[model samples]
Each structure stands twice: as C-alpha cells, then as structure tokens.
Target chain A: MAIIDSLKKISDTVWELPATYKEGMRVPARIIATEKLVREMDETVYQQISNVATLPGITRYALCMPDGHSGYGFPIGGVAAMDVGEGGVISPGGIGFDINCGMRLLTTNLTLDDVKPHLKEIVDLLFQRVPAGVGSHGFLKLSHSDFRDLVEQGARWCIEHDYGWNEDLELTEENGCIPGADASKISERAIERGYNQVGTLGSGNHYLEVQVARPEDVRDKDLAAKFGITIPNQIVVMFHCGSRGFGHQVATDYLQTFLKVMEPKYGIKILDRELACAPLDSPEGRDYFAAMKCGLNMSFANRQVILHRIREVFSEVFGRSAEDLGMRMVYDVAHNTAKLEKHSVDGKEKTLLVHRKGATRAFGPGHDEVAARYRDIGQPVIIGGSMETGSYLLVGTASGADTFFSTAHGSGRTMSRTKARKQWHGKQLQHDLEARGIYVRSTSWAGLAEEAGPAYKDIDEVIAATELAGISKPVARFTPIGNVKG
Target chain B: MPYQYLEDIGTADIAFEATGRNLPELFSEAADATMNVMIDNLGAIEPHDTRQIELSNDKIDMLLFDFLQDLIYFKDAERLLLRVRDAQIDKKEGKYFLKAEAAGETLDAARHHQRADVKAVTLHNFSVEKENGGWKATVLLDI
Candidate 1:
C-alpha cells in the first residue's frame, strides 16, 4: 500500500487526495483527522477510501471521519454522497452489515448520588430484563405476518402496541421509521431469523450503560437543561445496538444479489467487488433500499421495546413509576444508513444519496429535521467510547454541511481483537473498571478483555479532532458508572 | 492439532487462530473452527454427500467471505452440514479464484449439535493473507 503523494494538506484537520491520484475517481477524498492520527492509520484505510473515491457520481468529496478504519469496500467512518440523477450507485457495503446500528441517549432526573445506592440492583435488573449475548431471544415472538408489519412500520408498530411513548417517535430519526420498507422484498429465512430476535440485544460491541454526567464539561447549559440534564450529577442511560440478524441478512442478501445483477445488467465496473452496486433507481438498487429500510425500522422497533423494558426495570427497582424516574429519550440517531438528502454542493442544492458508515448525522441548528425542541440547539450526537472510557455528547454544527453533516460514531479500534486479547485479560480488565467504580456485566470474559479501553483511540482526542475540524461541537461528557455488555 | 481461542472482540463475538501445513488442510481447519463456533460436534456429520463450489473475488479476503457465506447459506437453506475436503486458490491480476470440494451430511438432531444459526458472513474484521509457506484467513460471521 503506497501513500498517494499528491494528497494536499488543506488544513491542520483536513487532508485531500485529489481525483487525479486514481482513475475513475468521481471526486477527491477528504480525510478529517489530526496529523498524528493519520500517521497511525493502516495503509489499507487509504486504499479503501481511494477505491470509494472512484465510485460513480460521488459528489463533493469522499469524506472520511476522524475514526476512519479499513472496511470491505468503503472505509469505516466513510461518508459519500452520490448524485442520484447522475447515475450514482448504491452499495450495501456503504451502509454496513449492522443496518441502522446507532446510539440512543436517555436522560433521568436521578442524580449520581441517587443511583449509587441502587447500582447493583439496577445493573442486575437490566441484565435480567434485557435478553443479551449471542442468539438471545426476547419474550416477544412475532408471527410471520406480524413480523412483516413490524419491519414495515418500525417504531410506530411498537407505539401502536403500547411498547413506547408517542413523544419518543418525534425525537427519533425519521420518526424511527424510514418509509418504503418493502417487507415482501425480504426472504423467508431473514424473516425467520428476525422473528424472535426483536427486543433482544445481540452481542459484539452492543451494550447498555449507566453514565454520570460531568457538569464541568457542560458547554451548552441551556440545551442541557432542556434535555433534563440540569443537575450537575444527573444520571443517564445510553446503549448501542442495531437490527441484529435482520440487518445482517438484508445486507448479505443484497450484496450477493447486487454482485450477480450489476455487472451483467447495468455494466457497472467497480473498483472492488465488495463495493458492488447499482443505480439508485435500478431494480436491484431499489429492492436493497427497500430491504435496508426494513432493517432500519426493525431496529427502531427493537430499541423501542428495550426502552419499555428499561422503564419496567426502573419501576421495579425504585418503587416508583417510570414517569417519576424521568427516563425520557433525549434523542436516537442512526449512524450506518443511506438517505436521499438535499445538500448544497458547489453553491447549489442537489439531491444525493448520502451513505454514512460508522458516522452520525450531524444536522446543524435550524435544520427542519432537527427536532422542534432542539431546533435552536442543533442535533445531539452521542458518540460512545470504549467501556472503560467516557463518551461525549456533541451537537451538530453548520460546518458539517460541507461533509454532508456527518461525524465519527465511536473511538474506533486501535488494536486488533486478537492482539488485544493476547495483551490483556478480561477478568483483570473487569476488576480494573470496577476499581474505577464502573460496574460491568458480560457473558464472555475474553470478549470484555478485547474491548478494553486501551484497545481504541482516546475518545477525547477523537472528539477534539472533530471539534477542531468544525464538523461537530462538544456539549457534555458522561463517565461510565455501570455497564452491561452482551 | 490443538485448538485455541484467538480473542473476544466484544459482546458474544469471539475469534480463533488455527494452522495447518497446506491450503486444503488450512481451509479444512478453518471450516472446522467456524463450525465449532456454531456447534459442538463435527465428527458426527456423516460423509454421505459431496458438493463442489467455485467462487472468485478481486481479493482473497472477499473470497473467504463468499466461501463462508456459501457454507452458511447451504446450512440454513438446504440443511447441509459441510466440511471442506479440498481447495485451490489462484491469484491473477489482483483477483482470487477459488475451486473447492466439500462433504457433509443432511442436518439431523441426532447427528449434529447446533449452537447458533449464523445468518450471514460479515465483513467486519475479516482478513486473509499469505503466511509462512501457506495462507491464513480470519472471518467474522454474523450469527
């Protein structure tokens, strides 16, 4: 892997490899990272991003967020908007296996002091109430017909069934349902796999955590107050998950089908087969889009059910109603998704298919998509760090418009899992986190150890890079007090 | 050969490292490792049928994903529990073409110990590279 010597340093935080660096590159590739982080990257990331640059109809720039890492076709943390009217291709790899894999932050009126007395009970209750680990199933068993409806309606299905609050939908991305999900497009095998998995947390970097708000890091006091983070030590719950097997199957089914259809039918020549795609309006592309939407809605419904379960557990433990606990959703945003959005490209508003992989939507203040309540303050971007480190809450910025309003999703892995396991022990890591007053519950000890805090880049540094690059602005930081890993 | 767990990436995810003297043996060992992750027994699968699969990809890593996905598809859709018997990979013009033969039995509760029904093979943390005098690949299957 050779470095593209033609890359020009546009700023301390931005670097660009012009289109001439590779053949068929529709646009230059812009990487948002500090010099130090850029140097630390594996050359595979550059190669992958460069391949992504070569995709047809890519608009503006093939942008890489600060946490960029090598992936199958597009680099993780990759964002690229393709002009649909100009023969753009929609690749399943661009959206990733975990469709709508995202973060949701919930605020609580209880303070750190209030939770300290019940930390053990709360963690236990969450672990018991929430089905986790590999192949875990929930109490909800959907019939084939109901499962299809669930996939089609998304969180609305949950709300209609009294599993979620009506207000929660407004705070969710796309009202927690992307329209045009064709349940009929999904395979029976996919439906079977998803039937019992709803409301369950499948394993691997998926978790539910109890965090203590650090008052010192509150940069937007007014906005924080509006989100019910008024008290300095208010406790909150944040979790990261997605559509599980349903999303995986949707991505898999499309990737294979697209590979079979695109080259023969559309004559689409891809830099990599893993990046197989078709025109957004093409039959194959439209089918994938519809199926991907099903995965997205399924995830929203999954999280909604989990939230209901959380309310139940809180009610049981505190001897108070969930309403009294103030367990209200602040916001839920999808990181891995593709949307047809309007963005200003070359001083003109153009419609493009924006694919965000391992990146969050950072719509700036006053954007109509921003919830009315937070319209003046911008969208709340929850970036989860490693279990041992603290995660940050950032607000979208106007500068993000230049990059299709995207930001890094997490701290991103620094060490390979094999290397991390050989270097650390899960039990010791658990003990170390416990010493720091962060309780952890996981099914596999080795799994816990490999995701040790040190295996990833310092989230603070990543956030600082994003802020310095003007992609997003930090609002507050939350330190982990308790965690439940699948 | 002895078996060893590579690492727990996060949550219920786990990877293992294995080795053999040649490509066929190595691929067979990899298939054994993958099946072990999903079930408890491989010896119990009767060698009643044989299947041949040929796949190609621009990269060896992608070929590995395709191979694993093929196995999972057969297992889920056709109820076939397969073991790779032989494999040949050729790299030309930056692409990998693979021809393989596998043997296994139809799924039967008395013959197989099932763990998790892996829905698909994921590209997450997937790798395949030449090592020593042979080849090695690591794939993350979405279970």
Candidate 2:
C-alpha cells in the first residue's frame, strides 16, 4: 500500500500525502484513519487523491475521511475545495452519478416496543407504498410544465401538492431546495427518464429502514433530546436514495461534454479522463452546475413524497394522526453535491466550491446556513451502517471545520458486492438476518445477497475513528428492526 | 471474448470487459455485458419486441459510451431489457455512425432475476482498443 511509506503521519489519526509524492500535485492530500485501518487501504486511493490534488485551482488539501475507499474519480469519502476566483473547476466525478444522493431521518413518538408486533406489517406497507427496483414507476404523473416546475421548486412543489407538510422543509438541507436550478439546462432525455422515477427508490443499497434508538445508545443527552429522540427504544424511520436515472443522465451528459471541451476551452490537463472538468467560472461549469441543481431539487421532492407515504402508513396502521405520533423529520443531508460557500481559508474568507463526493457536510455551531434550531449545535450528519449492524447520528464540531466541514458518509465497503454475493446466497443471507432479528424485504433476493452486512467496515469503529480524529462527534445510535430495499 | 464481469477489487461499482471479431460485434457484446450487470438471465427477455437506434459521433470512444448510455436509458424509460440483435458501423463524411436493432420484452421481475441497478456507464477506467484480429472494450458502471 502506498499509504504505508509515502504518506507522512501527521497525528495518531491523520496522515499527509505530500504534494512532492506526485509530479503534478499542487496541494497535499490528507487522510483521516488510524495506522491499523490505513493498512487495509491500498495504493488506489493514494493515486486518486493525489491526482485530485493536481487539478487546477485545487485549494488547501485533498481530503479523504476515515471511511475512504477507491471510487471512480474521487475516493468514495473524498472532499475537495477549489478557489472559484482562481479558476477552480467542477467535475461530474466530484458530485457522483446519483446527484444529491442522501439520507433522511424521521423520528416518531412510538417506541420499538410499541411497534414491535406490527413491524412486519409496517415494512410491508412501506414496500408496497413506495415503488422500487429498476423500472419501478410512481403515480406522480406530471405534464412537461409541471415536471419543469418540480425541477425548479423541489420539495416545495410536493408540499404544495399536499404530499407533505410545509414544516418538513425546515428540517432538510437547503430547506429541501437548492438555488440556481434551471430546468432549461436539463435535457429532454433526462426529463423523460426522471418523470416516472420521481417518487421511486431506484435500486442497489437504497432502502427505507425502521429503526430503534435506545436510551442507552444516546451518547449525548441534551442533543438527543433536542433531536426529539427521547425514551428507551424510540422508533425512527430512515431512508437512503437519490434522483434516480435523472441524475445519472445529467451527469453522463455533462461528463461527455467536459471531456470534449477540457483541452480546447480550459487549457487544463488531467491524469484521468474521468476527472474531466472546466473552470468554475466557465460556461460549461455553470451549465453543469445548473443542471446538477435540478437533480438536487428532484431528489428533494422524491424524498419528501416518500416521507409523506411513510407518514400515511404510520397513521393508517396505528389509527392515529401522524402529527400525534410525532412523525417529524430530524434532518436530511445530501452526500453527493458541490455547493458554493464562504469559508475562512488561511485566515481570509474566500468563496470556494466545496465538492463532497460520498461525504456529508459537518458544519459546527453558529453557521447561519444551518437550520435556526440547529444553528447553535451544528448540522446533523447521518451515517448509515449495514442492516444488521445499525447506524449512527453524529453532529458537526468546531474542529471539523479544518476539513472544510465534512465527514464520512457511511461505513465504507471492505469487500465488493460481487464477493459478498459469491459468499452468501440471497435466501440464506435473508434467513440469517432474520435469525439475528432483522426483517429483510427486498425486490430481489439476488440483490439482497450483494448487501450482506459482513461486506462493510465496522460502523462502530469508523464512527470512533472520526470522533477520535476530532472531525465529528457521535450523539446517538440506531438498530434496525425492519428494512425495505429496492 | 464474449463478455464477463470482473470482480471489483478496490471499488464499489461493477467492472467488465467485452471483445469480438469487429467493432460491431464488440459493441454487441458490450451491450450484453451491460445488460448482464442488471439481470443474469438473458433468456428471460424474449425477443418479441425490437428497438432501433442510430448514433453518430466523430470519435469511436464517445460513440460506444453514448450507445451504452442509450441501453440504460431505454431500460429505465421504456422498461425494456434489450439485447443487440444486429449492428453496423460506418464512416460517413469522416464521422463514425452506428445503427443497431435490439430485441427484448418489458422487464417482469417475476420472470427475470435482477442484480444491481447500474445507474450509468462511467468514464472511470473506460476504454476501447484493438487487439490481435479483433477489438476489446472495458467499462465501469456506477450503481
């Protein structure tokens, strides 16, 4: 592993791959992981991050969180900030294919004990209510103009259509709407592909899981109380998905264009074609950002609508109003996105394009961009683990700002899906999870095999690494009772 | 080589390679490889329907990339799991053009065993090259 010798250990939990390690690097690449965990990492991530450091106008450092692993252009848990004033660039690889792909957590008054007997019924209802898998269609029929409005208005469109409550907006990142979204920048092919998939969970690793938060797992009492997470075994529903094929098409469309224009228009060269990018101030960059915003909005709408469906299921099953059951959103965080923000760099505030691919923002207290209620405590960072292993709820800290306010997105894969499938048969794996008290509901048994729990890194350990690194602080933990996969 | 999925070593996405006697055959095999990433049972997709696609590009690399993107688009938009039944590539006015006919049926999950949902064909490690008497291509898919 290149990490063993080439990178210099900065701290017990941090390592620095110096700019001198590679030929074209303008900035050093920083990684947050212990020596024990770093040994599992191969040279691929070192290459990708160093390559990222070589991009024109890359600011400060190229960073990878504790859960970092090799991915397409950026490592899965990579974070980079570029100076827009100095001709910084934006690449689709930095945002990933599933634009605004994120996790949403909603808390309820009902506890695990209260919902235990009806767990199977609730999961079954969610599976039926929300269409999933490839080609899964939703009843959100929209005309061209309506769809365009959806792309523009985001979750607000669904709330206006009575799909969800207006209050739900307040709990979402960017209030469930990203600015500068222009439907005009979106292609007809992308619109057509997104039309039917607006409210569906399009496959692989995307799921809606019902979980329980025990009093014992609440690490921070005050914060957990603030998040409406109280009582032992409190139930919360969490889902992971994105803009479906709409986002994919948008990324595909831009990447091809970037590749065609990179040399002629930007006078920039990259180590890999997958890292194709244009200056942030250039026409190509602006156009792709506009199109990407549309993807962001579409995903917001998709999740809002899904949340509405989930609330309805709870209301129907428990014979109580959703509000009475305290079915309110805790927070929503987009993992794959690039946002323009003002950050203090080298003691001066600069407008930087922060690209977090498979990483989430962990802005600490007093950031005005965060929700008013959470402004004093910082943004909630949702870290999803495997179905059986449970998940974590962490909060941004003041020290986290060093990495430009970012943290690991999930328990990164320790093994590939192919290997997981080879080792475990889907039916048998399902039975095993059931034996361990997790109900597995998926569109395909074969798909279930690929997501077996043992394939991922230890979630508890990854969370501990981040906390020890002083990037983020853990507040609460969740164990899954039931889950529905696409 | 027809087509085969390479086990992912350092990445989370699916990677595969395809080879054939010519560019046209290589594209067909690549299509098969792409579809196999989604469904293992190609036999389940009966050839009762057909869709024709004509794509033109100055570069062969972009042409193949766009062609693969089209298959994913068709599957999502039309719910059709197509197999390239016929293909022809020609150079017109110094630009490359491809015309192909694909046959398949609407995806019936009960009939077909589905795998990962390939989101898009990625440019990461994507390539097309000539080797021996034939040509080969490598693709990585984001799921």
- Residue range with the least summed lDDT across 10 consecutive positions in model 2 chain B: B4-13
Reported per model, the fraction of native interface contacts reproduced equals 0.12, 0.62
Residue pairs whose backbone atoms clash in candidate 1: none
Off by over 4 Å in 2: A1-3, B92-94
Per-model TM-score versus the true fold = 0.86, 0.98
lDDT of 1 by residue, A22-74 (tens): 89887889899998778766666777788889887898899999988766678
Q: Which predicted model would earn the best DockQ? A: 2
Interface RMSD (Å), each candidate? 6.1, 1.4
RMSD of every candidate to native, in Å, equals: 5.3, 1.2
Candidate 2 lDDT over A1-486, as tens digits, reads: 335698799998899999998899999999988876677775678888888999888899999888888888888888999999999999898889999999999999998889989988998999999888876778788887898899889999999999988888998999999989999999999987888887888788788899999888999999988888987899999999999988999998999889989998778899878799999899899999999999999999999999999999999999999999999999999999999999999899999999999899998989888898899998999999987798999999889877999998988887777677788888897788888778878887777888888888888988998899888899999999899988
Candidate 1: list runs displaced more than 4 Å: A1-6, B1-27, B35-67, B70-143
Question: In candidate 1, what are the lDDT values of residues B59-111, reduced to their tens digit?
Answer: 66667777776776566435577888888877888887889999987767445
Interface RMSD for model 2 amounts to 1.4
